[model samples]
Target chain A: MQQSNVYIVTFSVILTVVLGLLLSGTSQVLGPIQKKAVELDTKKQILGAVLEASELSKMSGEEVFAYYDKRISSKVVNIKGEEVEKDEDGIAIIPENVDIGRNYKRKPEDRLYPVFMFLAENGEDVESFIIPVYGAGLWDAIWGYVALETDLTTIKGVTFAHASETPGLGARITDASVQARFQGKRIFDESGELQSVNMQKGEGRDYSDDAHKVDGLSGATITAVGVNNMLKAYMSHYSAYIQKRRSGESGGMAVLN
Target chain B: MSTETAQVTEVKKPAEALLSKRRKKLLSDPLVDDNPITIQVLGICSALAVTTQLQPTFVMALSVIFVMVFANLTISLLRNTIPSRVRIIVQLAVIASLVTLVNEVLKAFAYDMYKELSVFVGLIITNCIVMGRLEAYALGNKPYDSVLDGFGSALGYAWIILAVAFFRELWGSGSVFGVPVFDQISGLFGDDFSLATNGLMVSPVGAFIILGLIIWVQRTKTGYVEH
Candidate 1:
């Protein structure tokens, strides 16, 4: 059957209105739940850097949130290592709310760095500081969290995630075994210069004795290089904060220790 | 005589029961005889892309099935009113909306699965099987028959991709659904024997090779010859 121009126009308009309403309705209804899921995932990644993945996997979302509240406290810091209570917009900066991906596009100095501190059992003393890092991978964006011991040089643990990478190749960055390679690796060399941990080319090499080198994925040199660059860039970005903490520890606590 | 029989059947088709033999054929024929992937070769891109792992492929299949069935039904219901000039656009709008719904639902309820299948779920809007079925069957068929046809085509697409994933994940990662099967097999024997994983199977090339073999086997069994 032939449809006249007026009828066609009317049909198209009605279809657009109906579909627009339906889509907007669905989005509005699901928006909060989706936001919560994303928040939980981010928290999981942050905690994954400090806690065991197996343990985290077993916890429900509510349990993970409770555990995060118990063991973690956070603060935003500037490039100069000073605490940032409020952002340029005058809004109070919450470390958990900081978006690393959005900040990644801004100038290094302009970015707000959120530091999540893992508190010791006494709950007051800081155990390890987990810093989030972001960069590009071969296929898409790559990001991770790195936890540093109180001394602020040794990597306590790490967890990596990627948006799109070759499943068994570049994507192996998320593997626990791979992240475990970063444990105990120091960011600062003996000379006290910040030298970020390197993911060297090729796998199966024993980097156990090396302070700054971890084995790379065999077939994923580009992704390995991406990780190497990401670690170096983010570590250097946090260097000022690290130096400040280091000096503060030695300066204030000299008699107690 | 054949023309007279065809006319008689055509006259009787509308009054037939919901699950009549003709409708059953509409539901079952696509499994092998007119498969969206193997025989019709309609949605080969996703079949190759998501087949690298069983878990994501399974989710992809489910999403496609959901999208296809609903898209077909919606289009069939609106078949009479849809202007031929704007029918493609209408079909696309319906399909895209349904896919967005699936995506939003996944994000809210199964976030991990949503993350794993994010881009692929959006890509379902472009999968030709949905469009092809909407145009070929839904535009002229009744709603129930269109739905059955859509389900059949989606199932046909699903089984092929799932089979490809089975081989790919089993060989590529030496696992099934993330379980390290090869590790267990080696552990069963000891250090004396171990099967090296085929890394090629983890790549898109592996999907192509596996899909090609599947199409070849399926076509050979069905005796389908392309002119």
Candidate 2:
């Protein structure tokens, strides 16, 4: 009911200046700590998916780096079976801030060295190059790394994670139990055609079906279909690389593990 | 002008007599007695939406407390000059600006948690808990008392939310902070892992059930009059 011009002007200026100071000050102080946290967390996720949490936890981050270093080799191979980046480092760099509109789109330029984690007995190493697959899930996008033997046929290991999904239903993709089913499964049929893992339905999946089929998710069928679709989409895009690896080409899809 | 003159004179009485003892009422009142969400039934949407989990609920409560305390203090400081015709707008501008600061800090530092919260944090600008403090208590008090009033209102909102998140995470997934509270048989779930959900902890609707159950418990513990 009351009014004063002096108070109005002073309040606006005071609030604006105080807020400006607070916003800038807090970010300047907290920005780097947040960035480092994110970087470390990503390392944890990559390690967790490739190695058992119990095993990975036993090793320090440097040891994990050393494991990936000794076993994982980064390659920037093009679709034409040519090495894109080859030097002493053996690390292929993927550009950041990729804009694919939706996380499900194919922005082919975003391809680079896919990180591969190999697990075989000592000295034998792994004989496959693994690649990361990004696809749509039930409530959000899902991503996983799929490793292949040097032949690009048999699967080595698969790790998956989701951004947003129903915890009990669609979120099953992140469940280690669900993802573990993907391990040791063959990704190709006897004829050498791509037969990526399947999410089985009601009852149980007969992994020994006449056809090469992994069990599909039953309760969350749509999310299962999403994983199937994304798996196909990723395989198709890199068909050339897959074909090259299958044909025993040496330049692309070299064994890291 | 006459009304202004009369009100000014009225305000000059012993500080105790000029303002009603709204302090003792608001301070101790909301914390337990006349709690907003649990007791009075206000601002339950955010209490449910953000409290489906723990970490975000904690952050949301702190943000509301900060916003409320400052908004209340500022609004009270300018109580004498706020134009009657545009009072709500004035209160809103103060709240909105503070909320923006909160948003930026969350984005720059807690970006991941901020993404998890998504639009809910921005929606804080509309929270009745903050607005109610500004309009009801801050509009007529000294700055310090108004700040205290805001803090009390926020404390009321926080406890209810924490309780909601605790139960939701505990029963829905049978876990706390992502650690499994329930065990699974080996090789039953996937990759030789079997974890159970207890099946009830997955949706926002589930949050409502848990919240209602909590409200029932609180009501039985503390009887109140219909005001």
Candidate 1 runs further than 4 Å off: A253-257, B1-15
TM-score of every candidate: 0.95, 0.76
For candidate 2 chain B, the 10 contiguous residues with the lowest summed lDDT are B1-10
lDDT of 1 by residue, A1-257 (tens): 46689989999999999999999999999999999999999999999999999999999999999989999999989899888999777988879889999999999999999999998887788899999999999999999999999889999999999999888899999999999999999999998898899998888999889999998899999999999999999999999999988887888865312
Per-residue lDDT, model 2, residue A205, is 57
True contacts kept of 2: 0.38
Candidate 2 lDDT over residue span A1-257, tens digit each: 34467655766667568766876786678777656545544555555555776787688656765675465544545445455664347654442212222434535544443434454546355556566678778777877767666567666566776777767777777766777777667667777677776776642756754334567666788888788777666766566666765555455444522
- lDDT tens per residue, model 2, B1-227: 12122223235445663235766666677888778887877888887787656777888888888888888988888777665545687778788878877877776667667767868888889888888777776776678678778888888888888888877877777666656665533344567565555456557787788878877877788865466
lDDT of each: 0.90, 0.68
| Local lDDT at B115 for model 2 | 66
Best by DockQ: 1
